[model samples]
Target: MEKLFELSHQNPALFVDILESIKDAIFISDHEGTTLWLNSASEAMCGVPKNKITGRNVRDLEKEGLFKPSVLRMALEEGKNVSTVQTVGEGRKYIATGHLVKNKEGKVIAAVAHLRDITDAVKNTSKLQEIEELLEKYSAQIRKLTSTKTNINGVENVKLGGKSNSRILAKKIIEKIAAVDTTALIVGETGTGKSLAAEKIHLLSKRRNGPFVQINCASLPESLLESELFGYEKGSFTGATSKGKTGLIKAAEAGTLFLDEIGEVPLHLQTKILHFLQSKTYMPIGAREPRNADVRIIAATNRDLEQMVEEGTFRSDLFYRLNILTVKIPSLRESRDDIEDLATYFLNMFNEKYNKNKRFSNEVLKKLIQYSWPGNIRELENLIERLVILSEDEFIEEKDLPQKMVEQHMSSNSPYISDRGTMTEILEEMEKKMIIDALEKENSTRKAAKFLGVSQSLLMRRIKKYNIQLVVEESKTFVK
Candidate 1:
């Protein structure tokens, strides 16, 4: 130790180099709290050179906005170790740990502080909060559309309104699971009403009076996900909110906590979740003690948990715990028999909403049913609402359907040869057909350009390029 000290004294530049090599900023001050030296990291963090900061009192530097509530000053004043969150400039945050260096006589000789940059973690947490708020806003809108209301029995009824046998069986399974208070898993493809089913289960459960908090596990990064789920205490880490946060698990206290896309949870966090499931307790980020929560968990996922377990991406024990009461929701294609009813329901709902008397023509409805709805119920509802608001005619014709749907319905009669054509030829034919249809419907190049989402000059050029024949009458253009 004496030799090491002698070496440091002999090669002071080497010691300085070692201190400068550290990523964390290091600030050194005399017992009077006057800056003695600062490393390169400190200069970058404070946006000030060492020559300017040296010999300047910490109080003056604090006032000058280099850093607020100086840790070195606190350490000097208290004659002990001090730790605090320091703000440098407008959004950058740092954790500064300061300690007094004492001589052999117990006299404080200097104060040193180590600062770690924490801006990214703070920004990520803020972003996660914003995303959660936005998700809540959309969920509220969905609730309004689904008409979440209290019935005569005082139970919130979320109408999974469908007549298909598969849907009915899924609903029945959900109801049966809701009767018993246990962990549940809802399995289905995306847009197949997994979230809605989770809500229905929560409403039917004994904890209906409590809150139902739902979070999409896949929407956040792993760094933010753990804190969001279990929460963190105030003053626990740099840039944490002053009042801290109540995690989603705690928010659902006596009710259901629906974890959407549970398969996306990181492998490391799976252990924590499993522990919580087993003991009804979890430890928040930076927390010293475990906290208990009485919330029932309902996890939903499009990915097969069993397959994930086999592949080692998901924990088998956690999967087994969550799969206690499983409810599988069928996709819209699997329940095509209920498409007409579901479509009509959405149509009437949207018609009332828009104060329109729009009705789907039999042909349009037939076309809708014929198309394979890859996006499931959600897509169907969105299409119906769009038709209600956008269709000028009272009866929504087959032509009002989206171009992709129209093309799919008429693929058998399509002009482009699928097997014997180059990509360019097929695309050109498709473009020509779209231009002809738009010209016929709009009767004007300007209006057709708007419909086709192309500039007027570009549309004109395309017309000339394709050698499209146009019959002009007065100011209107007709497809020849």
Candidate 2:
């Protein structure tokens, strides 16, 4: 040790050359925490030159909560080495190690520390976590496909039928997952058969015979969601069932758990979910032992999760995990070619459900093709159900459809309206039509504004401009 110190003093340039060769930042500080020496790497790490770091107290570099005094205390007083993962310089992560340096008398003289950048390692870890989540999702989907009983009650088996686009997309997804296990995130507007795509993935996976559980994250509160997903012991909390319930995760053991509307899951819960996706295990509420989960996870959401991540609502790590094998379901408006087939399928489905043999009139078919269905297949299904139940004649005509749908047809067919009108006029007409349509569809301007893509003030202005009559509540009216 004496010989080394002599060499360092006599050949300070050589000593600095050795230290600078290391990729990690290396520094020496006196017992009082004053910086004595630092290598070139320190300049790169701290964004300051070695000359600036020397003759300065380490504490003066105070970077918020990073580089706690406790670390230096441990190296100096305890005479021990310490290591921790810390964020440096605007949140860049580093693995820092500190060690004490002793004099000839065995008394601590100074402390030395090194910091290695681990940003890439952190990023790779995040990607691995995502891949694991995708695997779990696929596993859950396999179980759902293999099981005969559907998870959703009262939802009859929907035959896999759609336009060429839907079929082609579905086939592509199935083919991709044929060999590997990866969690899949299905994204689309509401009612675009995202759930159906999830089911198909399960059916094609190796875990086909396992259970497939589905939950809507947006439909439940955070407190209740924890119990619903991870399950709770009996008397875990108020309103708890007597029989301790197994969480959907455990229930889906060796199967698949589908989390729909995953974007709505609370922020705190996201951390726990990230842990589960990484470890494939979780502790049940009020349970001490960690329960092993062999389930795959498939998550679906209609919201923009990446945007949510940027807004700090969704965890970036969790988002990456669920996004490994993303399948975007096209909106109904985007896939107009599929409308005729989907409409016909729904007509047949309702025909069987209602025990009625009704067909679409030529006028009704043309209107259906021309109309842009904002609600996708679910909307189409409801419309078909209404037609089958209300239409007395064997054929469904334009008059038998909803008032808003009929108005859309009229607006499209109107000679007074031009597609290429001035922006102001076009917006005005659109506002008027949307407000009227929303009121007709939902029966209130407040609710209409929510769907009309405009503010209530604007809707009211258009309503006045078009001289639209507001319908107050009339005598009790019922229409079959």
Candidate 3:
């Protein structure tokens, strides 16, 4: 058989080609650590050319805090084979194998090292770790659900679900009159958790153990509302019950009465309410006797009741009576800083409620913050619940958001949705543009895939299908 050195020297190109085809970087160095030969893979691994690497000591090209000199010294002086795994340049992982090369005389002559890129393996491991963590979280949440019962009365001392400022203000207002019997009027836009604030106020009050009666003035007609608020004697009206009916005011004796949509009360009923507020006395329908109510009233309205009073739609006297202590709830957009905390809170809440352990991706969180929540906290809570129920994965990605929200993000500057094109076409165009922009921003197909929440192969196919151009000029500018 021909000697191995003689064969390699004679067929250097063939040997080099074989090394290049092996995928792993292969490098040969002398006993003194001088590089002898390196393949194309080695050149790529070191970010240097094979010609430049040859005849140079590997230690001399050492980048501090990355590859250590001791690794090289052990491979050379100790004549021992060594292997190490290291992370290089941002998040790429490499597995390096070092072997002592021996001459025909059975003595060490040089060292050969091979490095394989294990970045994908490392990423999959990280993904597995994340999945394990999510599973553990799900398990813990399930255990809690099985062991604990949900509090139907809702959160205590905190607004049920709304902007942080509104919740804070509501808490403060609740704390202020928690020990007092003064009436409170909570005013805000619809779905701003006004009723929730009233409940919190009641829950924190001294009469919490007593019955809590809730009545909506707008839910019933003026005549029915009167009968509902005040008890009716037997045979008070044609459809009256055979037995006497107790009113909500009487039912809430020594307790709290939540009057929702209080502005909907008619003028005559407002007069009766004003009288009740002043004298704490009320009379049942068809009864020849007066009754005293020991109830604490908490009223809520989404209307500008003061304006209604000016327009003669509401009574100013009733407004003043209910507005003994007013708490104004702020809108969602006014408290943009609290969006993240609210989102997380709702995510966790639904995660436990539904037995799902879904997490919001950072991109989704960013989009949530960027959105102009016109429906305020209520809209956000509903959106989160929808995502939790609909999403299949453990993570709620940007794609999981409502299409309108995604469109709003893309057309942040566009005034109107283009009418010429179909909605599907518009959405496709938006997706293409967003994918291209993400690719341009990241400058890597892999990173772009992550940002777009798609697989690398899928992203590559889209890049080709959309004919998207990489911003080479922008990349050059970044390098500079």
Instruction: Please report the candidate that would top TM-score against the real structure.
Output: 1
Runs in model 2 deviating more than 4 A are: 1-158, 234-244, 410-480
User: What TM-score quantifies how close candidate 1 is to the native fold?
Assistant: 0.61
- The TM-score of candidate 2 is 0.57
- Which candidate's lDDT is highest? 1
Candidate 3 per-residue lDDT over residues 63-166, each given as its tens digit? 54334433455677666888787554444577877888787997888888777789898777767667645644653443333222122454454545444765
lDDT of 1 by residue, 43-109 (tens): 9888777898999999899888778889998888887899998998675899889989989999999
Q: What are the lDDT scores of the predictions, listed in order? A: 0.83, 0.74, 0.73
Candidate 1 vs candidate 3, lDDT winner: 1
Off-target runs (Cα >4 Å) in candidate 1 are 1-157, 239-243, 412-480
Can you write out model 2's per-residue Cα lDDT over 225-283, one digit (the tens) per residue? 78768977765543232345667898788777878888889999998888899889898
Worst 10 residues of 1 by lDDT: 145-154
| Candidate 2 lDDT for residue 44 | 75
What's the lDDT for residue 163 in model 3? 45
**Model 3 residue 368 distance off true place after TM-score fit, in angstroms:** 1.7
Q: RMSD in angstroms, all models?
A: 10.9, 16.3, 29.9
